[model samples]
Target: MTRFPLLAGAALLALATSASATSFVATTDTLGGLTANASESTSDISSSFDDDKIVRAARDDAASFVASNGAIRGAQLEAALRHIRQQAPQVQADDQQLARAILAL
Candidate 1:
């Protein structure tokens, strides 16, 4: 019957009612309202560790940390963690994962 087709069409329309999210844009005014975050440690551990273009110190630190089988935590390992946090602030992980990512690079 015609009623069945109308019901099916109504159901399809109801299923297609997903709305798009478009309000996440940060306008200039919104950006200006935010304060500068200076509490975070700004020291770059690899600043002195780099030479030319190759990041050998990070690799060495990661390699040494890996050589310890993750049982030993040292200044080199902490340097790797600081390097990871400085480069990728969004990364939320424990020491092992960050070390693995550093060595994997």
Candidate 2:
């Protein structure tokens, strides 16, 4: 009976090894063919933000507004939003969004 189990186990092991050999080589071949593009690039996300005159203009006001916990709105902040739109009409953010950005700073 012990001999029968040993033979069965050996047969299973041999079958497993043979099946794994084909799949293992196949997977390795596929992996060797895979590669990343050499021209892939990355950039700083903050560089895309509109932090020029608009963000700078709202800096002082933002500190106060942030300190007030969103309760206070400053005149300079409004002016900054208007200035941003005029200076760069392509800007698509709304008034509250612009103010929220300042509050973050």
Whose TM-score is greatest here? Answer: 1
Q: How accurate is candidate 2 locally (lDDT)?
A: 0.61
Q: List the residue pairs that clash in candidate 2.
A: none
- Candidate 1 C-alpha lDDT tens digits along 1-105: 999999999988766663211223445445554422221112222233335123345566667677888766667667667766776675455566555555554
Write one digit per residue (lDDT tens) for candidate 2, span 1-105: 899999999999999999999999999877664422111110111133346666677878867776776677788877766765675565455455555565544
- Separate clash counts for every candidate: 0, 0
Candidate 2 residues lying further than 4 Å off, grouped into runs, are: 1-54, 66-70, 103-105
* Residue-pair clash count for candidate 2: 0
